[model samples]
Target chain A: MTLAAASHGFLSPTGVEIAFVLVGIATLGAALMTVGSRQLVHAALWLVVALGGIAVEYLLLTAEFIAWVQVLIYVGSVVVLLLFGLMLTKAPIGPSPDADSGNRWVALTVAGAAAAALVWVVVDAFRATWIDLDGAAQGSAEAAGRSLFRFWVLPFEALSVLLLAALVGAVALSRRGGGAKGAAETLAPAAREGRL
Target chain B: MHLAYPAVLAVLLFCTGLYGVLARRNAILVLMSVELMLNAVNLNLVAFDVWLRDTLHAGQALTLFTIAVAAAEIGIGLAIVLLVYRNRGSSDIDRLRDLAERPSGPDGAGSADAPRQPQPDTGAEATA
Candidate 1:
């Protein structure tokens, strides 16, 4: 890894590296807005930008299939679901003063510390490593499909089962009668009749 | 491309999510932050997969699985947030302190009494 990285000097960046850095900066900015914005709806919108930027990053990385999946799943569905949740919960359209918790300063301090430490470690460790993107794309749809069906069949099937379980669990948890108050109310008549 | 770029980006995004999780009041916003964190992991996986060029392409495959699992997670998480909103008429995480230990009073009221009461006293309780 060090040898490969030594061949490719850090001062001279290729076009791909420049693009990746630019998009990454945009993504990071959008992410910061997503977490820091006072308007709830705008926060979700910023999340869309951030996730979309990540999809672009995947494309630049030559993971074509993963890029599309990221677009479809995250940019397409997740943000919409989040928007629906915000609306259903009656989140204020304008900025709300209490968008952040009281311990936000503490949270900021912790996150800053973590970011600084992790960034230092990752940069130092991977400084000598470089990815060779000159060859054919590694994550095209055909390659991904062949590997998925051939090598990763069992995990794929298991993931389907997990999805099904999640579906049922979500339904069960969201139902009206699942709450403690509802259960207590239902059992009140039984206790009144001395069935116990 | 230098591997440090993606690695560093992932770290920053994950920490941003961490901050959001700890600081955000709304449960849905917190869920969005979780998505950010998961996406960061996906970026790292793809970058490493491209670099390694393994025959099995384990990194990309796992990335797909992670995406699927994240989808399921968001579904379940949204359902839970909706349920909490339905029951309590609010989805602010800080106010949902049903499990938080409180100082004992002379009334001998159990923690069970906390969640059942209305949200009016939440601010006072948080201040105390």
Candidate 2:
């Protein structure tokens, strides 16, 4: 794969490459806005754009099922959950000067260094590697479902169990007077007054 | 497609999420950045799955699992954040520093920690 792909020069780009680059740029920009925006709700909305752009990238890579799943789960539910969280937290609608932490410069330096190192290593290693996105789509729902049931059934079932647990845990955590401490405090007064 | 394209994009996206996670004051915004990071990983998984053409389709399967887990994570995370906000009246990550180490003398340290501890107790009283 490496030897044959080495012949593919960076100068002449394919149509898919062009589309991927364009969408990737959009996704990256949206992601930057998601992190950098001052308004909390705007950040979550930008996250939707970033996630949707990633879905387009998946389609370009010929992974149709994952792309749709990305759209359904990420752009659909997760972003909504974040928006709800923002509203529930009473996040300021207007621009808040304290949106970024005091250590933002430190975070920027660390993230920049990490990005530089990762890009260098990744490009150096996979410079000659190519993904052959021709012929049949690799992640069509049919193919994914077949393999998932045939070989990945156990893990799939396990994931469902995990989801159930998370649902129950979230409900428990968010409910009023649900925590052990809260329950104890509720019972404490009655017990102290000899009501129990 | 050059594998470098997706790989590099993932790298940049992951770093953007890293910065958000570290820099964002709002816990929900941090979760948004975390979503970005997860999506970056999902992009890589789908790219490599197409590249390898594995019979088991491990990469794509793993990607689906990751999405599910991410959903679960966001649900639980938001719940915790709500709980914190209810108790503290704010969801600013920096302000929820009850566990932070004090930099003062032992007597002063106790005094420093004392103020922050009662807020939650008061919250519980109000709720009760």
lDDT of 2 by residue, B1-128 (tens): 88988988999999999999999888988888888888889888988888888999999999999999999999999999877766556688887777887778889889777886877656644543
Clashing pairs in 2: none
Candidate 2 residues A1-196, lDDT tens each?
1222343453588899888888988989999999999877788888889999999999999989998999999889998889888777667799898999999999999999999899878888987788998898888999999999999999999999999999999999876673556443444344324622
Give the range of the ten consecutive residues with the poorest summed lDDT in model 1 chain A: A183-192
Specify the CAPRI tier of model 1: medium
Quality of candidate 2's docking, in CAPRI categories? medium
Poorest stretch of ten by lDDT in candidate 1 chain B:
B119-128
Quantify all predictions' global Cα lDDT against the true fold: 0.85, 0.85
Q: RMSD of model 2, in Å?
A: 6.3
Give one clash count per candidate, in the order shown.
0, 0
For every candidate in turn, the CA RMSD to the true structure comes to 7.2, 6.3
